[model samples]
Target: MNSFTQYIQQLFANEVGGLFAAEPAPLREARQKSMDFFLAHGLPTRKMENWRQCPIDGLVQSDYRMQREADPYRPVEEYFQCQVRNLATQMFPFLNGWFVHPDAPLTKSANGVITGSVAAAVKQCPELILPYLTTTHADKADRGLVALNEALFNDGLFIYIPANVKVEEPLQLVSMINTDDNLLINNHNVIVLGENASLSFVHCDDSIKYGKTLINNVTEVHLAPNAVMHYYKTENKDADSLLVNHLFVRQQENSEWVSNVVTFNAGYIHNAIHLDLDEPFAHANLYGLYLVDKSQVVDNQVFVAHNAPDCSSYQMYKGIADDSARANFNGHIVVRQDSQRTQAYQTNRNMALTDEAVVTTHPFLEIYADDVKCSHGATVGQLNEDAMFYLRSRGIGERTARMLLMYAFANEVTDKVTIDSLRERLANMVERRLSGELTLCDQCRLHTSDGKVLIFDVDPDKI
Candidate 1:
């Protein structure tokens, strides 16, 4: 085995015993099984078909520490202050791999909704979380990183919305890595929505120290019959960090699920999303937007399974790559034999701002049902010269024209966001990123007066 795999195995060996002692028997057994699966598969390499386009060799070779400990010196509000205006939210923060609550580790709402650390929830309400823990995507065979997350994750967010309850305000979960040391953070979250329950959740991942760190995160969500869920994820990390995020969702009959992923900046980010429509009349909408520059790499992989009849799924992703940045999109839709009358659609579009920028897209549809309707397509190109000229001819400056066009392109995805405050914040952030005004200093709330702004000069030869 490689050194990285060996190191991970040793860490598990040293920590699983303590974890077993603290948890119930079923959870402990599940962790052991996950460890075995991870050991069998080891870490993925470029040779693997699913991971060929995104190589993580550098991340694996880096020296990082994996441990669960909270930093008492740092206050939660220092890292994450409320940014969305007029939106009241319950904020849950995770520093490194440990959940840092402002007062306690967990809390409950007036409507009996539970929000807190996953480890604490396991002890307080095992019955509520045990059945759904590590069980959403258990049938997938090639989920090595997911298994690793199951084996090593010590703490993350756990949210439960009881039956017939609706949360008016959104739940905000923020995870930040701010230590000076190189760290390996593995976190897993379990979210359950009971029948007729509804919730809106926003999850953010950021970095303050910008150290060489590796973050592996997994989340499982279960929606009961007639439930509704709205989920949003924002990734804004430094250039020295590597992040891998996995999200899986299972929906019952007549349920509705909507999710949006917005990536502003990162060194390397791989986002994996899976949706299983296990019952009839379920609907899912997945949307994503990414803006990357420099040598950053961003990869988004989405998989949807229509296991029941009369289910619909839609996916749309748009990205922009500048300088030597790279972006990738892979979408797969599967319509099983019993999934008749299933409708699925997927589209990925990208714009490259420089000759060295790279964008790869793959959209696949596998149908075993003859009555299913599915369509998938991808496009990669530069900004339209004709549109640029049209705007310039109308007295708009070249720089302003390019910015307006790019903003409009990205706004198409953000406009789909249902939350007014979140949509406004994202619009501002995307504009700042495209204009080169968003920098690492913004992450730490450290403002400067350098007074430098990037202006996009139209290149005639490239156009």
Candidate 2:
């Protein structure tokens, strides 16, 4: 095995640590079970189907590190504080995989919404969380990295929206990593939305310090009958970090699940999203956008399973690569024989801003049902030379013209955010990444026509 693999093996050599250690009886048992699974399986490699394109060679070569016991830096505190003030929704903040403020106010009168650190929630409401805290490796059976996470994750946020409740505010879970120690860090989150409930969640991943660190994160989401869920994710880990995020979602009859994944910064990133439509009329809309610069590498693998009849799924992903960065988008849609009348569409579009930039797209559709509407396509090319020339003729500089064109290219996916504040935030993030700005204030401001500033609705569930 390579050095990365050996490093992971050594990190979780015998046991798991962090939040799982203090859990009560049953959960403690489950935690132990998950830990055992990880010690047996280990980290993923290029051989795994889901990880075929994004190899974990670099991550496995490093030692598993932990953040310092005390908070030595404050990179995201201002953002979280701003979110708390401007966002009308409930907010949960985690820094370096640990809950910084355990006493944050919760709008308890806001119906049946449960939001808190996954580990704390278990300690406080074990019975309420017992059923939903399993690892993503449940099916992979051999995913070593996921197992390792289950064994050693420090803190993760858990959210649940009960039946018929519509949360107006967007629930925000922000996770920040500080490379205090030089070992691997594992984090996990579990979210569940009950029947007819509508919920929106955003996960923001950022980091402080510069070191060779690894992040293995797993998230599980369940949408019950007629439920609606909207999810947005942003990853901006430092250049020396390696991040692996796995998301598993299940949808029931008439449920709607929408997801937007934005990867603007990272040294090496791999995102895996799986959606299982287990009941009739379930629908999934997936959109992804990635902007990579320098020598960064980003990979996305998504699988949508149509197991029931009359299900509809749509996927559109776009990538913009500059410098020597590389990106890969792989989309797989499968329609089973029992899933008649299934309608699925998948598309991947990529633009290489520089000659050295590279992108690979694979959109596949496998169908066993005769009466199904399934289509998949991918396109990889350079910026529209014609468009560039046309814009330049209007006095726009080459760099500015190219940035605008690139923004418009990614606008298709950003427009799907639905949440105005999120759209604005995502736009600013895109702009900042393209322009190499790390501070949000330096990012362009977005406002509606009425002059009412649109802040990311943190309490989306409250609305």
Candidate 3:
């Protein structure tokens, strides 16, 4: 075994006893099973087909530490106060892999909805969470990574919405890593929506300052019959971090699920999204927008399963790769034998700004039902020359014209965000990111996160 594997084994050997000491028997047993799997197979490698395009050799070779205690650093107000103004949200913050705040870790709404730490949920109501924990991991391709996360995760968010209840404010989970030493962090979250329930949630990942960290995160979402949910994720981390995220969803009869993933900044990012339509008339949509440059890497894997008749799903992902950056997209849609009249479509489009920029795209459809309607396609090229010429002929500056096209391309996905306030804030952020001028702002600390603002010589919107 390599040094990273040996280090992890030794850490588990010394800490496994106390790790599950306070948990119930089922959770403890689950962790043990996961441990066995992880010990048998280490971290994922390029040998695996699902992981060939994205390599983790650097992550496995680096030394990493696990935070064993909750150390609430002083002056929390000074460092953690950055937030989008005029955007209303119930914020749950995490620092250095542990949930932190002056308020209680768990909160209940007036309608009996519970939002809190997963550790707290395990302590308070272990029985309620048993059925949904790792229920879909049996078929996942990266079982080793999922197993490792389940075996060693520190803390995560748990959101439960009761039947017929609706939450007006969006619940935001913001996790930031701030440490000089290299570290490995795990986060496992579960969000359940009961029958006829409605909710809007936002998950944001960012870095406050310095760190060479590896974050192995997994999230499971369950939607009952007639339930409606809007889930969004915003990722903007430093260039020194590697973020791996796996999202699993199970949709029941007549349910509706929509999600938009926006990646503005990161060194290396891998996102795997899996969804199952278990009942008829259910709808699922997955949209993503990624902008990377300067040696950054972003890889996305999307799988949708239509198990019941009359179910429909759509996937649309777009990216802009510049300099020596790399981006990849793999989308697979499967229609089972009994699933008739299923409607599924997949499209991936990318723009490579330089010759060195690399892009790999694969869109596949496996159908067993003859009556189903399915189509898949992918395109990789530079921006449209005719469109650029049209803008330039209208007296728009060349730089502004190019920026406008990129913004318009990205705006297609950003416009899918459901929350009005959050959507407006994101629109502004997208514009700033395209212009590469975010540092001009002195009022918002978000300027320091990663990207810039737009000061147009001649307004392109008017043109």
Candidate 4:
């Protein structure tokens, strides 16, 4: 390991050493094993094929320490309202990587539904928490960051739904990471769904303060036979935030996994999502959208592995870049030897608003089985000028017309945002960014559906 890697290890060893020390015997031992793995691999570099487009040279070159609070605690409610309050479900709140909800209560329903923190579940029912926590996939790559999180994570979320129980309301896990010190923030989460259960969950990650901090978060999900899950995640960290997110999903027979990934913040962001189709008749749909502007950079990598036959998986990602920002998408779809009759599709499309903007896309398909049907494609280009002019012909100004055309272009993907409120919220956020109200992109005036064009006068900071 280089000096920077060694420095990070030493810093973690000295500070925040007692956080994970109280965990159960198995988890505590797993934490140490992950730390040793990091010591051997260090951070990913350009030499690695997966890390080629999203190297961490600048991250390692800068000195970082484990973050700690220097003053009083601030609640995440101060920055964002509970928009999903009417959704009627369990809500878990985290501020600066710590769970602050005092009345955070979870109980089992007679129909077989259990929900609570892993720490709490372990005490009440160890059998419920044993099969899912650190179960099988330990991950051979990216152990450094995983180790970092396992060693430091204190607050986490755990949800369980019993057989035949369906949650009508969406479970919400809201997390806000802010630091008083220049250190990396790590978090771990676990969720389990029983057979024939249905669930929808949303995760929101934002920053409370502007500071140079690294965030590494991991969430493991397990779906039993005939179960269904819909997951939506949005991250809006500060421009100085360095974020790494890992999501793992394991699906049983006839299970479905639908997930959407959206990132509109952070100076440098890296996200990896892995889905394992462990049985036949599994279905998965993955969609992602990222908006990068100024000097910010966001990288997303996804892997879908088919271990059984008669499974289907679909992947689509879109990116919009402005100023000199960068966006990278690296997607891999793997079909095992026994995964015959598997059908998989993957595609990535990116648009650069300025010549200085940079976007790189790499879509790969690995089929070890001879009878599998898999296809993958990638495209990187600018907005279509013809489409912009076509809208302008009907009295729309240049700026307004461009916005309308771009909105329609992105809508092809946004329309698939199955959730009602989230889809509208994301569409408005994209519009605000396009209008330069967020300071993440250049200023632009837009026309409404009724043909009235207006320029936004309010400043993003003021709003």
Backbone Cα, N, C clashes tallied per candidate: 0, 23, 4, 1
Q: Per-residue error at 284 for model 3, in Å?
A: 0.5
- Cα error of candidate 4 at position 51, Å: 1.4
TM-score against truth, every candidate: 0.93, 0.86, 0.92, 0.88
As for lDDT, the candidate ahead, 1 or 3, is 1
After superposition, candidate 3 runs with Cα above 4 Å error: 73-78, 134-141, 438-463
So what's the TM-score on candidate 4?
0.88
lDDT of 3: 0.80
Candidate 1 lDDT over 1-463, as tens digits, reads 7888888888888887766468888887788888888888876666765677877764665367976567774565543455555557877877778888656677887889888998888888888878866453434555777888888888889999999998888988888776788899988998899999999999888886768888989999899999999999889888988898999999999999999999999788989998999999999999999899999999999999999999999999999999999898989899999999999999999999999999899898999999988998899998989999999999999998999899999998998888897887777777777878776425323111343332222222221
- Candidate 4: where is the Cα deviation over 4 Å? 2-4, 11-17, 60-80, 84-89, 103-112, 122-124, 135-138, 439-463
Number of the candidate with higher lDDT, 1 or 4: 1
Among all windows of 10 consecutive residues in model 1, the one with the lowest summed lDDT is 454-463
Q: How would you encode candidate 3's per-residue C-alpha lDDT over 245-332 as one tens digit per residue?
A: 9898999999999989988876789998989999999999999988888888899899999999999998889888888988989999
The best candidate by TM-score is 1
Better of 1 and 2 by lDDT: 1
Candidate 2 C-alpha lDDT tens digits along 1-463? 5555455455544343542445666656655676666555556657766666667644555455665243543333333343423345455666666665635422234587887767667666667666766433555754676666665666677787889999888887766554456646666787888999999887877664566777788888889999999999877766778888888899999999999999887689988898999999999999999988888889999999999999999999999988999899989999999999999999999998778988888887889999999888899988899999999999999988888788789878888998877786677667656656643222212222344443443222320
Give candidate 3's TM-score. Answer: 0.92
